[model samples]
Target: MSEGFNEASGSIIVRDLIQVIHEQRAYLSEIDGAIGDGDHGINMDKGFTLTARRMEGQLLGMSESLKLLGDILVEEIGGSMGPLYGTFFKKMARVSKGIGVVDGRVLEQMLESAYQGILTIGDARVGDKTMVDTLDPALQALKLANSAGRGFSDALDAMVEGAHAGWQSTKDMIARVGRASRLGERSRGTLDAGATSCYLIIKTLAQSMKELSK
Candidate 1:
């Protein structure tokens, strides 16, 4: 197999992301109900559905598709999630601007860029019961695996594990940001909506890249 996926695979990648979010919409909203507005899934579906429609019949490279998704999320979607995810996707697209094929190393860079991008706007940190709970550890694991000379598949698996662990960690955390923060101890028993969604996003990216690597 090649060391990377073709940059042209972006359309399919984004399409699968839409599918994943759509399928998990109800579950996401349910999780949010524990301490949040219970509309994270609804809003996410709205933005991803729009992105899917816009990508039809267009032959976009990975960066182009990612940029389009970021634009739609930033401009059309409302709430804190809009800007956070928009920055993440946009940063990934920016870092990948000139790449023809996206390799494991490039993917590591993209993930780091996305993580830092979120931190730029969101004040959330590890154990904050936010998406950073998922993203930060995931990036760390990916970086560690890559630095250890792990292959693409191994590094991707490591990231998946890290993200899952981070997502789970949110369940034990006191909500420290957003609406959930108001719930205090009530938020401890449930998974964070943002963290759950973020986990799905990371998992989807890893799965898609794994498939494309073949």
Candidate 2:
């Protein structure tokens, strides 16, 4: 690969992204455990595990891999997160509509596009204390880093830091969305489960892309 994300990324290891999903799954679920129903890990793991296996079986090319992953997320997984995350990947696949390898710029566009998709569906904005909480900051950091001509790994590191801070900041935020909102004042001390998971997953992906860029 050259510098950043490559759409052909799926056409490459095909399994590395899946593996990152696997590694981050529990951490996300754990974060969810403190507030929500605590199934983020289980649901995400099931969805991505199937996605990984499905991609292995069906990915003959880049578009094919992206499409196949979308199908799995839409048709295979269960629960609220299935559609949400499934949509994220499906939207991400759009930026690489043609080729297989997605370079750093392509990956950045994909992430930015995916974030838009999530925002549209959920109607969550920054300070909503949802996944957007992590996404917006992380993406802005990436945009600034990319504009500065920073390398992929360096930009990714900045993203990780931003994501972590975003996740942590949620602890101080009131629940403006999701089931946690039911808690009212009681929800103040806990981090937004979705935001935290979003951070972990995005952070893991950035790190993975950094490696791919090398």
Best by lDDT: 1
Q: Model 2 Cα displacement at 75 (Å)?
A: 2.7
Clashes of 1: 0
For model 1, how does the per-residue alpha-carbon lDDT over 1-214 read when each residue is reduced to its tens digit?
5577887765677887889999999999999987998999999999999999999888888888889989999999979899999999999999988788887789889988988998989889888899999998899999898999888889899999999999999999999989999989888889999999999999998888888989
Best by TM-score: 1
Which residue pairs in candidate 1 have backbone atoms (N, alpha carbon, C) closer than 3 angstroms, thus clashing? none
Cα lDDT of candidate 1 equals 0.90
What shift in Å separates residue 180 of candidate 2 from its native position after superposition?
A: 1.1
Runs in model 2 lying further than 4 Å from the true structure:
9-14, 24-26, 58-66, 99-101
Candidate 2's residue-wise lDDT over 1-214, tens digit each?
A: 3664445544443355567668877777777777788887787778768867666555354445655666677788856676667677788767778755555566678779888888777767888668888888888887888888887777788878878888888888877777776777777887786786677677667656666667
Superposed Cα deviation of residue 55, candidate 1 (Å): 0.5
